[model samples]
Target: MISKKMADAINKHMNLELHSAHLYLSMSSCANALGLKGAATWFSVQYREEMAHFFKFYTYLIDQGENIELLAGKAVPNQYKTLLEMVEKTLVHEQLITKCINDLSEQAVKEKDHATQIFLQWFVTEQIEEENNDRDLIAKLKMVGDNGYGILMIDAEMGQRVFTPPPGTTVMI
Candidate 1:
């Protein structure tokens, strides 16, 4: 059985994941409004991934026989000065999420919930990749600076990104 503390934390985290998805979707809308298809595509993909993360937690809680308590949603800004600004914000947000995941891992250990600990291992590793990707995008955005050509090039490259669900995972359409 899942401990109350662990269950509460996971439930809260799941809601946060939903917030993350909303944030990303807003960013995608901003990109689309600015006619940056590539940036929009990238943010859309991130939005979908965030939704997947939410479902993962949701499923885990249900499978463990825990009641899910979804918290209230939070508002996120829908405007960005530029793609660079958007990516920078995303990196900062990702860093915050990484810290949150680490805290949850610590909680799992403190509660001696081996199952939760094992489950969180995936998220711990995922954060590393998440931060790395954000950093890489930040670097590219920095290099381009205010150059229109560079921005378009980056956008074109990002436009080719397609969402591919992880093996054995089913994503809602």
Candidate 2:
């Protein structure tokens, strides 16, 4: 059985994942409004991925026999000055998430919750990939600064991104 502290931590992170989905969905809308169709598609995929992550946590909590608590999340920002700005904010947000996950891992270690620690290792690896992706995108954006054609090319590439659940993720979306 999972400790109440660990369960509560997972619950809180689950809600953050939900908020992430909302944030990405909002970003997708903003991208559409900005005429960045490819970027919009990318953000839409991101939103779906976040939802999947949330469900994974939900299922884990249920399996642990913990009562889930759904809390209201603060509103997400709907407006971004530019695609670069949006992506920058995304990186910042992801960094925050990485920190949270690390904290949870630390807590699990303190509580001697081996299962939770093992579960969080996946997220630790995921955060590395996530941050690397953002950094790569940021570099690309910087390299193409104020270049319409370049931005469009990047958008097209981003459009090609499709959501694939991580291996061993059995939680159905």
Candidate 3:
């Protein structure tokens, strides 16, 4: 049986994952409004991925025989002064998420919950990839620095990204 403390933490993290989905969806809308359709598509895909992450947590909680608590999420920003600002915010948000995942991993270790620790390993690795991607985009955006043609090229490249569900997960994206 999962400890109460661990269960509560998972619940809280699950809600955060849901909040991330909303944040990305809002970002996608902002990109679309700015005429960056490619960036919009990229955010849309990211939104779906966040939803999948939320579901993964949900399923794990259920499998652990814990009751699920769906908490209301706070509103997310829907406007940005520029694409660079949006990407910068994304990186900041991703860094926060990485920290949260690390905290959860530490908690699992403290509780000696081997199963939970193993489960969180995926997220620990995922956070690394997430932060790296954000950093890469931030670097590109900085390099372009208010160049319209450059921004458009980046947007086109972003639009080429497609959502791929993590292997071995049955979560619908």
| Top lDDT model | 3
Error of 2 at 2 (Å): 0.9
Q: Model 2 scores what on Cα lDDT?
A: 0.91
- Residue 42's C-alpha lDDT in candidate 3? 95
Per-prediction TM-score: 0.96, 0.96, 0.98
RMSD (CA, Å), candidate 2 to true, equals 1.1
Best by the TM-score measure: 3
In model 2, pairs of residues that clash are: none
Task: Write one digit per residue (lDDT tens) for candidate 1, span 1-173.
Answer: 78998999999998988999999999999999999999999999999888888888888899899988888897999989899899999989998898889999999999999999998898898889888988888899899889999999999988888887643245574
Better of 1 and 2 by lDDT: 2
Give the Cα-based TM-score of candidate 1 against the true structure: 0.96
**Tens digit per residue, CA lDDT, model 2, 1-173:** 79988999999999999999999999999999999999999899889888888888888898888989999899999999799999999999999999999999999999999998988898899889888988999999999999999999999999999989876557755
Clashes of 1: 0
Worst 10 residues of 1 by lDDT: 164-173
Q: Rank the candidates by TM-score, best first.
A: 3, 2, 1
In angstroms, give how far residue 45 of model 3 lies from its true place. Answer: 0.7
Question: In order, how many clashes per candidate?
Answer: 0, 0, 0
